[model samples]
Target: MNVRKFIAATARDALRKVRETLGPDAIILSNRGIPGGVEIMAVAARDMELIVSPRDSVRPPGGTDAPAGGAAPELTRGADRAATRPAEATLRKPASSWRPDAEVPLPAATARPLTDAPPGGEGTSAAAGAAVVPAAVMDEIRSLRRIVEQQLAGFAWGEVARSEPVKTEILRQMLGAGFSPRFARELLAELPRELDAAQALAWVRGRAERGMLTIDGESDIVDQGGIYALVGPTGVGKTTTAAKLAARCVLRHGARKLALVTTDGYRIGAHEQLRIYGRILGVPVLLARDAKDLRATLHDLRHTHMVLIDTMGMSQRDRMVGEQVAMFRDSDVRTLLLLAATGRGDTLDDVVRAYSGLGLAGCILTKVDEAASLAASLDVVIRHELRLYYVSNGQRVPEDLHLPNRPYLLHRAFKDLPESSPHRLAGVEPGLMMAGGGEGMLSVGGQRG
Candidate 1:
């Protein structure tokens, strides 16, 4: 087998070299990142053919060929050991000689992440030394190219500022509200083709409200009550939100109807803090360290009308979130992911994606009053299709939490407007927006999908 190594400053350049030197039918054995650049292993298809096949019609790995008028090959310990032998032996064969699959080992690509494979890859290594096909590598390359194009297609605001001052100002308002650039650009793209300045915002405000989802028609979470567990990253006001839900339950029904259970055993004095709130509300607080403990605790509090579980604080990046989510499998509990409105749009998007897969009932947006703009968090909620159950603006127990109002949110988007707004759009002439080759135009069809 003739193996060659190609090194370049980038994967693309290295791959180009492999194609030029080894021809189109070069098999890539492995690739790795080094201090200066990337390293790729390649060999010509003909060379690989000599090494991988013992006969003209080569037998596939882990399979056997039948001789004429003979029974299937008998299984034996000796045959099994030969089948599992290392690939190094096949590679170390006498120069320019063919070998069987018995000595070939699995390719290194199988051990690395899917992304570590060659860019324009198709199909796996055939019999250890077979060259990878273009079909496999091109699939990943196409995907990467699409992503790059999408990012480069973002709204070029700097060029837009040269003309169309009115449309530019509308974009300014969207960004000022703390919405993500991708989301803000998509929203503006959906506007009417010939819309005037006055009509532009009215169109967007209506679209945003319709996009919002909710658990019940009203914001009252108790309307569809069950075992509710508040799960999210640290410092999103899960405890306070849980307390507020308990307070509402207590006010609507009596103390006997509400029960507070906490699984926050990690933080120091965490259970103690929940117990203090339990004392204030005159409700019992229970602790559960593991899945079994949680099941037992809920079983003991089975008679209670509403059980609010205050979960421990954890980073969304932690793998334990999957374990924590799985704990509710044995029990009948609905998950409510808590989010902070002050969070960045990208962070909120990641948080929602991480928690949304757990069959969440909905989400509660907290610290709205502290957020410079609610668009950041709201954009993520709308994009992920997660329903908004409640919004918290203050520290007050039950008073701060309220149902989401579309009209109120729309009003807030355009709040504190300058008096010159009406006159701003009066000066721009027609066709000025298209002056810069139309690249500055918002991609009207690019919605949150």
Candidate 2:
């Protein structure tokens, strides 16, 4: 028997070389892909008799063939072919020179004929023919498992130890309000590590405790009586929030002191929506087409104590953002940018930037009830240093709007008392405690507790 090695750019080329050099009867031993190309091993025999009738004839001690039908040939010629072959070689050689050996060891647990057995076997075969797996393969598998376990353990510990207190508080609030825990967890994990684990957790808890509709900025201010415009992007509930604030003013002052103005002629029922709210509240509703018309309307309603202007919902991409800004210019009306809590950070920034030319008084956050997290909104508010005035939750007027008191807002936003745990009220003050609270009661009096 003779063994040879061949290498080629591809597996096909290497196999072709073996077949050409050793004839079509050459047995392939092994083949593997290396950096430069494929490597293959092949075996061939020189004697034609050894290649033919391999299973039936055996080579005696002097290389003479045994007589036919005599107690089976002892050293089957074909057995040598199987013995010389490697396990990794998938292709089989021609049966012309192959034969079964009388003393060939059978597979340990085969129920079928040995002919159906896989190429690699226990006896009368090369060590490679058994296809024994290398130790490195097992090592690689174990290494991968360890790496995965390390990653999971790190994540779990960070979540429970470092991130648990704050995340737990925030998650409790969100879950209490019917949010999916899986989604809440995913969002929390994806939050950028801008704040430390403690601060991030605290921020999340604050958002949950504050409720979706609660505002986080200054709300108490002397009403400088004049026309005030509420402007924001499309679908942020500006009209509804306007009605809420107007209702609050009317309840505090009187219906006679308030008037409603709308500049949303783009949508069919936009004007009617505000008009219906005005009618229910017993306030006058006026429409302004442009800056000149807005000026005229302001003059017409000069006697009104507070004029609330509800503008149309315009896309940030709309060309009309500039037009709207121009209309609000040089007017006594103070503009409040209404931001939706669910809006992306970049979109929020764009809205604020586009409307900055209008001399914004501050920002009013709407649809707080619909947001999963308020970090993006809070970041915008704090980064721009814009005062937050009101937060609106529902469509109900005078009920959903709240004045922003930082400490109170923060306390509510961060409040999460575990029901099963003992109330840890060690440092709490009497004024900070709620009227009917026990454990986890937070009291805010315009200062940190």
Candidate 3:
């Protein structure tokens, strides 16, 4: 048997060369890809007759007949000629007729050896038989590891450690808006490494999950024939929201079937402002001084399909907070808490707590167009588990207020920001920094710090 190793630019070409030089009977011992292409090792039994053939002209056909000193020169010349010949042409030649009776020598086995050895030999022999990974493959793996380490070393992992709170706050807000924790984590993980303020905001918007709000499938408003109050803190557009609903009811049930009621008797021009809306919509406006007056007004409008109650904006700390809640207690009326999208987090919380006594049927989110983070308002709303009834974006009656749709609300929560608002790291407040074990903070780059 004879063994040979071959290297070529590709695996296919190397295999072709082996077959040509070693004949069709050659056995492939090993083949593998290397940096340059492929390497193949093969073995073939020597054709003894071919060795003595005229083409070789090395040993005499009669075997060992030539003087030992003369044989060396002839053998060296034959080897040189064989090396110089084209591999394909050599492989095309016919086998020599001078066959030898002696057995051919066996080539050393190139197969990966077994590592499992009988008991005592395990330690030393098994180690020796272990398969060796090629040097080229080892080098490639090392190079990849180095590249990853270098890239990671340049990142500011320390900043991420400090900003964990901010990321948590962002995640908390997302969760409060009805996003699942798993979905939030997956999305936040993909945030970019660097961002400006506008970019960070954009990243937050992009990473937020959709479908945060739930909508009532029934399109028609329930006809519970008593005063339905719109109560909330200052500047939440209650007056406008009431007008929009009044218009909708009138459009569906006729002007005579609807009435407008104002319990905001304290605010200057509150009655007069609603009066103006009443005149245009052609619905009657009634002024209620107290809960007793409210009940009386309800009785007067008994024929009405809907009666919209607009209350004066009150501070959460105002002594009148409970008074307003009392106004709806004994009446056969539904109450709604109105919230402004532009209001602060704490302020929204106060409003919700103040209105808790009224048995709020649902909530109306107003001034969405003016808010920087609508999710903040939504966070408060969903936390209380209040059904969202309507959303008002502008002052336009009937046109601006829309029946809140869950999918639409989710889209708003996670929609991408305009190109003008990129995320940035500068001007971030120190208080915004996340404390250890607190909620994670989303950085301007969309990454949790």
Specify the highest-lDDT model's number.
Answer: 1
RMSD of 3: 25.5
The positional error of residue 156 in candidate 1, measured at the CA in angstroms, is: 6.2
Candidate 2 residue spans exceeding 4 A from truth: 1-224, 408-449
Which rank order by lDDT, best down to worst? 1, 3, 2
Q: Let me know the TM-score candidate 1 reaches against the reference structure.
A: 0.58
* TM-score (all chains, Cα) for each model: 0.58, 0.46, 0.51
Stretches off by above 4 angstroms in model 1 are: 1-168, 215-219, 413-449
Worst 10 residues of 3 by lDDT: 94-103
Query: Clashing residue pairs in candidate 1, if any?
Result: 27-131, 87-105, 120-137, 120-138, 121-136, 121-137, 122-136, 122-137, 189-444
lDDT of 2: 0.57
Model 2 per-residue lDDT tens digits across residues 317-348 = 78999999888887878998998877776688
The TM-score that candidate 2 achieves is: 0.46
lDDT of 3 by residue, 56-97 (tens): 333334343333333233343343333222222222321111
By summed lDDT, the worst window of 10 consecutive residues in model 2 runs over: 439-448
The pairs that clash in candidate 2 are: 51-97, 78-99, 87-128, 206-413, 206-414, 210-413, 432-443
Which should have the higher TM-score, number 1 or number 2? 1
